[model samples]
Target chain A: MFLLTPVLVALVSILMVWIFKNSDGGTERRKGEARAQAEACPWVDEDLKDCTDVHQVEEDANGWQESEEDVEHIPFSHTRYPEREMVRRSQEYYELLSKRRSVRFISNEQVPMEVIDNVIKAAGTAPSGAHTEPWTFVVVKDPDTKHQIREIIEEEEEINYLKRMGPRWVTDLRKFRTNWIKEYLDTAPVLILVFKQVHGFAANGKKKIHYYNEISVSIACGILLAALQNAGLVTVTTTPLNCGSRLRVLLGRPANEKLLMLLPVGYPSEDATVPDLTRKPLDQIMLFYFLKTS
Target chain B: MFLLTPVLVALVSILMVWIFKNSDGGTERRKGEARAQAEACPWVDEDLKDCTDVHQVEEDANGWQESEEDVEHIPFSHTRYPEREMVRRSQEYYELLSKRRSVRFISNEQVPMEVIDNVIKAAGTAPSGAHTEPWTFVVVKDPDTKHQIREIIEEEEEINYLKRMGPRWVTDLRKFRTNWIKEYLDTAPVLILVFKQVHGFAANGKKKIHYYNEISVSIACGILLAALQNAGLVTVTTTPLNCGSRLRVLLGRPANEKLLMLLPVGYPSEDATVPDLTRKPLDQIMLFYFLKTS
Candidate 1:
């Protein structure tokens, strides 16, 4: 549905190109207006701009055909850090991340919409499998929608905690003491619902399978959390098991889309508290093998 | 398997506490030495250290038992950023990430082992599902292992390109010009095989179910990629769809672990190039609903 507009626009340009190629064209006065419109609407196809100028249509088509013929590549560019700076940055980032906690008590204090936008944009930069970019972010700040989502989650969580989860699972969660109730869902000013698109419809309306949709969405969500943390916002990753369909219905997302996680984004409340948990040390989490030494 | 060591240490400390409580046998000198040793090893439990200090053991146990009485909570801490700095950092990070590309041609230039270590450490900080953190990263630098992995991946990729993937998939991949050949696997100096542990063995040998294992691991992998990129290293995510079992066998990981992705890490070759692709514009990926406006 998202790409349909672009695809339709491209098709219209293709038709325009066909007409310009065959017709005894309009005056230069009309052509100038078309060029101005094309320049203004940057979203329009470049070929359409050339189509308006009949003299350049053939040349543009030739260039397009050539590009279609050979695969193109661009030089990779990156910023290199000095050794000390790299180390310092790594240390600082590690320290910053170490302080991050899975906060549940989120303040209803209003977060600027721009903060949420930038975080989502940062998330969009994540590399996806096959560059499918098969994910969508839905930011819901409406009271009613958040209420609906909270209701759907609590209901499923009730079953999950009471019956679906095994005794060991329940015991494991004893320290966290999380229950069926999810007040934070309605408490946070913004709820970012991450949706994973399993497949997409192509320009030709054919079904295009997305490779590693689960992994791609997870990666994006991870980046989202980090971005939010970097912005000094707080969140906890909450997955409502057995509520995917309910969430889809409420969010008005398509059948192919699945709710990956619901993040309640905001500031930590004045009395907010989290489990005093310690991360596994590097010795436990990592094993290094230097080739020179090994 | 991972937490067993900590649990064992805790058990030994519990025994020591029992002994100290039953008979006040140890002299002040011996007690002082034990307390000093515990202080030296801060990663060892604070409870264990308190146990060594007789006067504090009762108080600590009372605190611990009550924490065990109900769920415990600690204050969440974060560093706040000034407005300008926040904007600048976000823009810089976005720009840095924007330059990141899935480089295929890698130079086997020697990257300091410390760099890889720090990058992985950054990735390890990603929040996990229910705090499970169920992931194991296997860094394979041995030439023989890399060669074996390359072989396994290419074999499956060949089959994938030739048979398994639909025509639409192949057509979609046409622009990337990627085929079954994956020489970068061998050309790169290091390969990190990320494994997702579906469940873990607890200290008591009971099976512990990890929630959203796929999502948790994916998030870590994503952060790993970004961390590597931030460190000026290049990598491409390669998932060998059918070779998880083989990889598990090769890597000596247990049955519970599933190989998620294999990333070949190194500097991009001087002549390396990537497809010039634009990310989907922000408007397409994000929908914002501000409470005040809505």
Candidate 2:
């Protein structure tokens, strides 16, 4: 009986290992098969046809000469963890996002640089156009630069809000109690200007074209918002309030790059106040085959 | 020393409790204040204005009836986990999406009904326009309906692909090796007819206004894609290769809604294949700023 026990135990252990290894192998095989099928797909590239006549993206993809040494390789497995805390994580995420307050007024006490950096690092993780990541964040810390930006923004906003450029749409914006006057520009310690570069060069100077540029940038913005909320910081996502051309002239951005958003990031002032706005209901924002996703 | 022990213990414990209570209050206060600030911020409204006409919204808001719930009662948490396994998750997501191959040729082998319903249920949670959600997903499973849809879709697609629309865009689409012949419409067990409601209701037979209809619908699509991926199903996001209005007429959609995307949702054929396109890298898709907001 004692001899039989060891033999039985060995069989069970071997079986367990085999099952685990088999499952892992099965997943990989499935993925590879899926990828193979995807590669054979001819429909997704349906738009690629007339490229022979006008422009093909092949050159843009091939010429990049970014050196591995200079390029930051974000280690893929830096934050591996077990699955037990997903529910807790989801709860915290909801709680933090629920705390997301769009603030305008700023007393501008120094924010912990570490926190700001961490949030940006998170934002950097946002998905982007053509994977071009096609954005440049320029933080204007100087008060003078902030004023310069504010002036430029207000000037363009004034034109948009008052002139023909803004349709009934812009006029309606007036009801929301907003003006071109941005006080946070001067008050906030940092102004992060997000730029979307429409196209860039690989080392061979072949241009890299981005697909769904706006959508990609917008996703990145969403991720950034989530990260900032997680960091216990307050932020106001402010658009240029102006156009890219004017802002480009003001900020001296290259032609390939356009200003996407101007963010004023800081702590809320001690006595800052906000308007009593409300979000649309869940029934309003969510739609399905008439069900909820989460 | 024995006598002193009780007194000291009592004092320290009381102090500890007091500190804990104060910190709790502080947290509550901060949370309340932060949400209030978010609600009242001009920027929040300002951002909304970009998506919805504030004047029309104000008119609605002014006459708005309060919901049974209080402002603080609402929640907007997606998940608590940031998903520490970036590579694993990214790979998972890619695999999930990669599975969304266009199934032009489907076999009516009677797929499980829950697989289809569960996917649609997940899509319903997408955050969108004025929270209007503004989308309708109609699942077509019957063979007759599928055939009719395929016939109708192909009729318009032939015209579109042959030449009747924007040249640059349509021409580009052809390279991907796609034509409007939708065999899967008849073959798959389900066809998702997605509509983007351009306008909203008038609670009292009035045209209720919606802001940023297109943007709202677009976000909903993103959510739908995410939900579908999460559910272990696959779909092709098929923008009409034909005039939306023409397709609408063919599909018998309401006059107010537009044919946005026709999703063919189901499992891939055992031998289905796709183009071997590479997804853009993380750095290429993400950008960072000096300040971050989650």
Candidate 3:
């Protein structure tokens, strides 16, 4: 479903582009009339009759694109492309998504797979650096894979929980009541694995450089969050395993990429609970006048 | 408008609570029923039943509140709140807002004050840590204030543009064709300042630590963007200011707060032009698994 929507949008957008492109057939004629009038009279004439012959002259006598359609393009030579309506629409979609909250302890009911596909597709449209588009999403759905992933995660979590591989910083997570064990990861219907491809494939089997990998990955994740929420699914964004190397080996990830987070996605249980969190006031989070640059 | 909505929700919620509380006054009847049953039960035959003196039992029964209303009190006993249909309906209003964009140039119009108030109120509801909700938004609609801001930014921009702020980094920013010169400061009708409060004022008159300041501020800004856009306004997110101390001194900000970005909000000019920048493709930004944590 996710794949289909982008294709549909792409198809529709392409059609719209063709329609808009063909509509601008009158821009050239106006320019031609202006040029003919200028050539007919080098000086401002006392009589308006100085421009009489120019009205019938060929627009675009200079002949940039000398074709039958050129005659119809003279009036709109100054037309710029319309503003990107799709991008503006995307921003609005994300704004409504801002209301989505993470839910834990989900109910037994299964979330439709189509919903997940649509959400991932929305994430796929996020812009990246150099158009390299070097990201892959591995959706974990089967219970066995989730269990295996949990096992791999738990081994590292045990070490972290035991405080062998961590410092005082580990204790800080307790404020949010996070634990070494992540049960929701196993329980949630899906775990989205976000991987950044460090380089592109080359003919010689070598790697090509990728630019802005971190920023590109982050923006994509941001879009994914928005998409999932937009689709009415809740997600819990779990971050890098503080214990590090354990997760990579357990997840069987290639050396070229690292684990950023295992985002658990599903509906919240009727009894699901969240920390009673409050946000900072609006005044503190937005800047209005001080740092403006045109 | 925002203040009123939450206040009204709370007020109505409290009124419901009062109704529920007042009805609890006669709930003592169930106890009488249980006691009467205990007296009538035949345990050790007559001796057990002997306690059923009619007048005493009647007096005791009258003393206890009736339990017949228990069926009617079913909803009160098990708490369930109203459906958030209105909040969900609010999304449609935001969906219309999805048409707004981040324009580079803005028209100089005298922005109405009421519009600004609604946007700010919309911005205030963003979620935060421990409900700490740590953000502030300062909206500057004054023309003279904008000029002062532009002057200060120009001082920093001139230095950065000249390769004085590290040649390699400055050169990269130039690739985007961005410069320190800020014309939007003067061109926009409104300016919004986003700040994250690292600490909060405690009930004990002391500074309290705030958690997740970055995420908190980012969320609020996201809402602000939506609100402004919903109101048919465009905004540009600018963060060229080094802004730590320089802005603190300039804006009379407290030391605990830091600047994030300056947003110029208004309608786009009829003949505005923007850099022909293209967004990178989506695949490059979203990783299927964690780059480090998966």
Candidate 4:
């Protein structure tokens, strides 16, 4: 086990104090933001003094909770690992991810439905803009349905490879040699079709626009991939352009939902292969700037 | 340790055979995708036929490896946790995310530079659309730059709040009561200005269009936030609309890059507060369909 230097221990203590302090004062009054808002913008003609009153707080009437102001918040405590443990955990996660590949050839091996459910549940925990989890996972397991999707997707891909893509674009794909032929679509035991909700129908039947739907859905997809990889599954991230409307119609989905990705989830085939690509090294991808000391 | 049931062991053995088969046949030829591509379409004349010959594969002159086909692939082994261990890890991660709040009040407390580096490195490990990795993490610590950013963001936010937003938007924000003032921008010790490269510059200065830039960058940002939270740091996802052009200019970034997200990283203030919020339960976000056992 690695030991922390005295200076490093001091820095960690400071961080620990900050973390403890954050979870400590949950019951205390949180008037700082309201007070700052009122003081910072006095240009509003309405008297801003009443804004800081805790009694004026409005609670959600139709929300899941009785009232937003009265919502229960319990204390959160996290396990703090020693320096050696932290290093070990970080290295383990990094190594796990390093081995993950964008698999192209997949087998029709049957995966237990519970494994998929757990990963999707893990995906739901991703944070979204304004807490609007504007994403949905449609787990497709019916073989007939998967075959239909593959047929439709291949038709579009034929056009993409023949007329849609430019010469330069095709040249760039020389490494992977991917020419729109999606055999894995039908071969994989399950296809997770992800949809991004552009708008939701409120209780009043009015359309509510979702903020950052693209960004939020992408984040959820990332977590989903991580969960699947941790569970020892392999998949390829496939995007078939110009098939959104067709997919929505075919799947009998609502008009407000747009298909973002079609992921074929299963084990890699015995002779499966991926383009032996490499990510840019860490130094090229990261820039670290420390506070300058005089 | 929880023992695996005999039934589960059988299932796991099936899965293990599939996994081992994939990494075992290193010398096998991968003609499935290339053959499928050829048979699916007849448009690829003699020119495209040569593209499939393994001997004709182009070696990466500048890359760290030789030809993509000749590149060695090592065995990808994952840690198989006991059922109890799996449940515990999954629950722990979910609980950790549940407690994460979008903090508003930030302290100027100094954070170790190493912590920030590790998280950003974690972010860069996110999988991209086609291994493009078209994202840049610009760590901003200069006070002058932060001040300039604050001034420009506040100006745009003022217009967005008062002039651009509709009445419904303002009503939705009633709980937080957020106005044009963005004190956290300058108050936070570091601002991670994430820029997504819409296109890359080739060695010869030619433009290379990036696929799924928006989706890829968002995934990276999600991993970054998870890493930060795991490290016991707090941050808020802040987006100052219409300030992207000005920000690009101010930061002296290249034209191919666009501002994706502006994250303020620091310790939460002593009196820090967050809006009372709730996430929809798992059933609302996920639909699980098991394969018909018939």
DockQ for every model comes to 0.16, 0.02, 0.05, 0.10
What digit string (tens of lDDT, one per residue) describes model 3 on residues A25-88? 2345445545444332211111111011221222322321111111111111121212344235
| Candidate 1, position B259, lDDT | 75
Question: Which portions of model 2 miss their true places by more than 4 Å?
Answer: A1-148, A162-177, A183-241, A251-294, B1-143, B164-177, B183-194, B204-211, B250-252, B267-272, B282-294
Off by over 4 Å in 1: A1-71, A288-294, B1-71, B289-294
**Cα displacement (Å) at residue A207, model 3:** 11
Top candidate when judged by DockQ against the true structure: 1
- Residue B146 of model 3, lDDT score: 78
The stretch of ten residues in a row with the least summed lDDT in candidate 3 chain A is A67-76
lDDT order, best first, reads 1, 4, 3, 2
| DockQ-best of 3 and 4 | 4
Tens digit per residue, CA lDDT, model 2, A13-82 = 6655655555465457556644543222211111111111112322232442322222222211112122
Task: Using DockQ as the measure, name the better of candidate 1 and candidate 3.
Answer: 1
True contacts kept of each: 0.42, 0.02, 0.11, 0.24
> Per-residue lDDT tens digits of candidate 1, residues A11-113?
5466556445433232343465455543322122221110112223223423211112235788877567877777766666666666777888998988877
In the range B146-177, model 3's lDDT, one tens digit per residue, is 78878887887786557344343343344344
Q: Which number leads on lDDT?
A: 1
Stronger candidate by DockQ (2 vs 3) = 3
Kindly report the docking quality category of candidate 4: incorrect
Q: Which sequence of candidate numbers ranks them by DockQ, best first?
A: 1, 4, 3, 2
Candidate 1 local lDDT, residue B232: 82
